[model samples]
Target chain A: MVDQVHKEFRRRDLLYSGALWLLSLIIPDPQLHYRREYRFRKRDLFYLLTILLLPLIWSDPHFHHIMVLGGIHGILALGLTLFLGYAGQISLGQAAFFGIGAYTTAVLTTRYGLPSFLAFWASALTAFLFAYLIGRPILKLKGYFLALATLGFGEIFLVMVRESPRLTGGVIGIFDIPFFSFAGFIFDTYLKQYYLIWGVLMGLVLFSKNLIRSKMGRAFLAVAASEDGASAVGIDVSRIKLGVFVIGAAFAGLAGSLFASVMSTANPETFSLNLSVLIVMMVILGGMGNLYGPIAGAIFLTYLIDELSRYQEYSLPIYGVILILLLIFFPDGIGTRLRIRLIYLISYWGRKRRREKVEL
Target chain B: MFLSVEEIVKHYDGVMALNRISLQVRKGTVKGLMGPNGAGKSTLFHLISGMERPDSGKIFFKKRDITGLQTYEISRLGVGRTFQTLQIFGNMTVVENVLTGMHSRIRGGFLSSGLYLPQIKKSEEIAIKEAKEILELLGLFGRWKWFASQLSYGEQRRLEIARGLAAKPDLLLLDEPAAGLTYPEAKQLAQTLSRLKEAGLTLFLIEHHMGMVMEIADEVAVLNNGELLAEGPPDMVKKDPGVIEAYAPRR
Candidate 1:
């Protein structure tokens, strides 16, 4: 009886996979032909539609809060993508820069009573300087060694935040941080913070798009492709690496500043290894080497974690299982895989309609 | 002399890669360096291009000692090269690959580039025009939009040369430009090299195609066991006993 049941199960599994294969082969993926064209169009539409409809669709404060968090994570992922995806450098300690940004804003606003506008720029500058100082040494290492060194930096930042009671408010962290304000307009509510973060994300995205399409961006691609070729073509490889690293850190810093202001708090726990890994995950899950991959990844993961919170104690384990299964199927990214599948389905339906018309 | 190498020696873990190699080439001449497997043609190229520093030697380009300068510095001083392995950017379009080679000439800092300033746009327009011209010059104009990886082996080899030429280099170091080309493709590459020579660009090449090398090389240097065995015109170098013995060893 056991042998009979196992045989039946195997037969069913084979049939299911065979059917999937046939369906895939019959349909066609348009992404292979128009990948770049679709990305450019879809990205513009996504930003436009969100800006127009987000306020009406997500009026609730809780939804707004989630959107705000998603926007901040989006910024962080964008920066990480430039370093990891574009420049082909792996940084596992991105949260360290985020932490520095948050801490800078928190300390500056709470202790020194600096204005929000000034504090925001100061936070980014501080993170940029930090990245520049350490990048020269750390950027020398490649691949996994670079990843580990960055992770170490993140851990060091976490420890510093925890230990420096008088400076960073210790484990309890800084509280009552002021809201981000421009001139006289204050972003005090979740609704305002949502628009603020998303607005900044849009600007940064445009800047990133321009940067990626420029001569310097080509140099980055060349460097990533081959160091010897890049140098042969007159690119200062080390300088480009360092520049991208600092720029990524600066983005993370800006995101951190916004995050601290929105939450009105800065805590060591918020910028831990878990957050660093999550940001990296967002970049990978969205897609590497593409501009909006990180944004798509950030929103998906932010919503996923939020939705999975209903599982209570089992939330993380279930999430882990889903992530692993998804990764196994779509190693390139969820966006690319979904785009291909969607295109295939549409083409399949179109072909079926044409065949029916011909028979008639 | 446009470029000269003097007693350059290199060793890797006590294995001598280049043993006191010396050579010179006049301006606008095609110099060919040929040797058997592991005869240090690549090592010599690396030393001259500043990819690797020589243990004890000096290199002069345009009469300036450039033995230990960084690769980018040497490249900026007009030393361009192509890899033995095709290093074309696989994802980027053909024109984009050549535009990458224009990195030294294009002038724009991060802010100007990020903002897409007027001057930067002008420079970019000029670069695109120049890159397209390069593609046209190499007979790859129709495939300008295709990705580098999509091109055939011969086209990719030509694309690599196009990228090197885009740097506007006074001298180009080509490492095995005809490595995987068909006979016709190799002949076409030789024609292109001859045209480049006529246009006043000095060429330093390491090729295994004896026919192609002998037909086009203004000067040929033969390396045997990491040492220069013969240096003369192609016919004279081919007739040298040491050069003949280096290719076919006695059992």
Candidate 2:
């Protein structure tokens, strides 16, 4: 849900800000693995700098609201990327966890008189519990079968929401959910909420990035490559996969809580297959395996959707065309692939400039 | 005996892959496993490494029964192995593939890893130092950043050795380490194995390349049709009539 932006200007710079946010989140590699083990990574330092500075300069409530949604989606996509990208597992049940979190926030704050902060954690816990219970049996299935299992899970959650009219508000959905607050400070407006959401998202981003640089992270990739090979190296493949799945579920739940607080509603329709597919599209178009790519994908898609909404009915088909175009050009996601292309261009220019200087 | 395999029998769909196969390996010595095709060479390695349970048998390492334990558990108990067909995590970096091999050696699980705790960083720094040393040993130090898949065939083979070595296993079981290497590469691998032996590491290897195996193996065990045909000093095993009949150059 975004505030209306009728300013007579193209938001190209905003799109770049998102792209740059993703581009700087690149490379936890080679240098960190060996020689300079203790030094602060320049890329990470710049990335954090970018996260804080961007919101201050862009003082549009509409842009802020849109980004608040983007941040929430960023969290969801990041979670999915860990399972799909890092651990080589897929899940279409992400929205089920999201719906649970949103409803938990809605029910607890409105009925139980619990704070939204407490409800946020409760959401994560409930999602984690569901993922653990279900992941044990369904995680054994691989490839498309696993996707089907997760899809079934999403459908089952929708049925439960519909059937439990007394608790979940049934067809009308829960409303008047209080604004997200920590201690006494309230995230009341889109600007304040933007910081709240991005703040949480940034912390998660750093945590995930750090995770991918460690021993367990390698185990995820190893499992992704080959379960037998991973086991041979003494990597506990099942535990690794299950852990990623549960963590991913927890992340989705957290995002859902944020969504409920910001939008002040919990509805069954929002957590449908379309939302799950859109999140998947973000990861695919942004990039998989690495965190920034998905976040970038989230940010990019948020703006595109905002702009295209003006066309109303035509937006859906336009979305399809754009996705195909992005994938055809950037098959591995635009973040890393575009960065690589940029690096090549820079090096080429550097050489050309040197030649010109020599000729002079 | 430092490592002992007692009558490991394995069946896949009612066909015996390993039938009552047994052998012993002394500490700090290279024990060679030789067999013809379908002679159950890799199956013996798989059972010992805990990839699959033996139909009935036991494997002891450092005086503990490791049979049927999880592969990682077996690895933690100082048993490491490579594959006949390469099992490298190709998309991962060379160092990451080896770092995965060091899984049991390092101790950062979800909580510590997610938080990026100080102790975890300390351990990671140590692990990276050690991992680099392993890569250097395999001549993959320069290209440590390269994706495992991008490496050439022989480089990937050596990368697997580098990975297996990262576990610091007391008993390393290599299944055809020289399977795809050229003559020079095989000779180089033989030297590396000898160096490892000289450093007091124990090795159990299955090799079809008799020259490399004969040069480095302290003792040899020959299997034909899932049963040990001969076991003795390399020179004596080569001379045995049974080995000559099964593993001879001509069919």
Candidate 3:
């Protein structure tokens, strides 16, 4: 009976994967179609269509740039999700690490005349080390204390970026950043940049997923649930907290570096305290604890921002109203509610099928 | 002796919590540590489990000094413990909680776990099988998928015990296992502890229930006002004047 059940679960999982694959092929690009249904998963077919159509959408000129921006935001959101959602540590220092990555890439490429790809990774590593050092002391503080400390860190980083004249190019920001490339193929065009960023984002997502399912992920969950309980159960709560913090920051760094290269500049304004808040908002609006929550949140928010930008003066207020509504009605976030609804539907269908089998 | 503590003292904010307490546990024996509320039984458990360091004194497991080891290190040293307040992972399923208990036994690291390596898969399979057997033993087989928070108080307590046992420890420290149990539940727990004892596992438990302690404890140690008051067989400790006086209601 156990074997049969296990086999059935595996079969269902495969079906789910196949359905996802098929669905990825059919959705229209968001840049081409500004419909309300395109903004969120309004229908069962919508998610399927989006997945199926992602590749074709990336091939468009304007959609390609939007995809790059989406990919960068997705990576940043994933990082925040790990720290805020899984590990239960709220940090607003993500923009600081993002700044670090952008600046490192900028300095390496413009000043040092190094390869952009090497600079990108170096920037990420630098951010990871910075996070490891800073996170040790900050992670000891709980909740709002850590949040405030991280906010301070972000502010300090922004100020330094603005003040540093020679290295950071001061408030004017660094320009003439070399484009991302592989084996001498420069990703200068929107299409090339889109594919490059999308590939990296997918890799980050897969890596993050695998990490979430690992022992480290379990330790993070334990720490998140209850520190005292985790300690009692022989988990090194502090170490696990620090590990997730650094890793999350590294993702932010990678996103920042990619953003710098894609935009061909590194500016203090780009990594502001507002960006940190937005990242945190994205994580929460997605669903803090769910893995896919941030992804959905990032994509949704990106499109919302894109659409709202046209309304210029009303954008901020519109965003505020939307967030308030989401929090009030869907406290678990869109991703979690959708998941719950899916499970309910599946179980309902299963029950009906079982009854029909009995009748037959 | 599998574990020993000598002249351990603990203080909290200048107040004595455990004053020069000492104890010994032989291999494969169920020893009882009994005391009134605030008698420092829990503090002693905390000190031994590496939750906190004793102000003065030494702790050893298998003749190796472990005075200042971390909790995870202590756990890795084959000393597993359950919490007084029931620290079972509430969000996880019963089997997942048990698998967490068997974390030390699983050898692969994050990479192996992420990649789902053969070793990790093998270990995971073994862990699931062992967890099932443990649940069956504890009469919780049917509730494997249930969240631990949904279980009855007695079942949760039993699940905590089962989690501790899943570690396959040389010594198990159970803190107030009978604190919230009903009469039948306490009786069942006593039977389970006795079975564990017969299976050659050493146990050090704190209990407020005298009936359960007296029924199952082969040896008993008494603490009063953060100091050891008496130590002997269960009957002898029960009859000790200090033990009775410490627990008795005051006029």
lDDT of 3 at B243: 82
Error of 2 at A237 (Å): 0.8
Instruction: Evaluate chain B of model 3: give its TM-score.
Output: 0.97
lDDT to native, each model: 0.87, 0.85, 0.80
Worst 10 residues of 2 chain B by lDDT: B242-251
* Off by more than 4 A, model 1: A1-46
Instruction: Give the alpha carbon lDDT tens digit for every residue of B1-251 in model 3.
Output: 68999999899998899888778998888789988889899999999999899999999999999899988888878888888887877756678777767776766665465455677657767878999999998889999978777899989988988888887888999999988888888888899889988999999999888888888788899998898999999989888888888889566
Clashing pairs in 2: A234-B72
From the highest DockQ down, the ranking of the candidates is 2, 1, 3
Q: Give the TM-score of candidate 3.
A: 0.87
Candidate 3 off by > 4 Å: A1-49, A55-60, A339-360, B249-251
Task: Please report, as a residue range, the 10-residue window in candidate 3 chain B with the lowest summed lDDT.
Answer: B107-116
- Residue A295, model 1: lDDT of 86
TM-score of chain A of 3: 0.81
Q: Model 3 — interface RMS deviation? A: 6.2
- Listed models, DockQ each: 0.61, 0.64, 0.31
* Number of the top DockQ candidate: 2
Clash number by candidate, in order: 0, 1, 11
Instruction: For residues A76-195, write the lDDT of model 2, one tens digit per residue.
Output: 999999899888888999999999889988999999999889999999998899999999999999999999999999999999999899999997899999999988999999889988
TM-score of chain B of each: 0.98, 0.96, 0.97
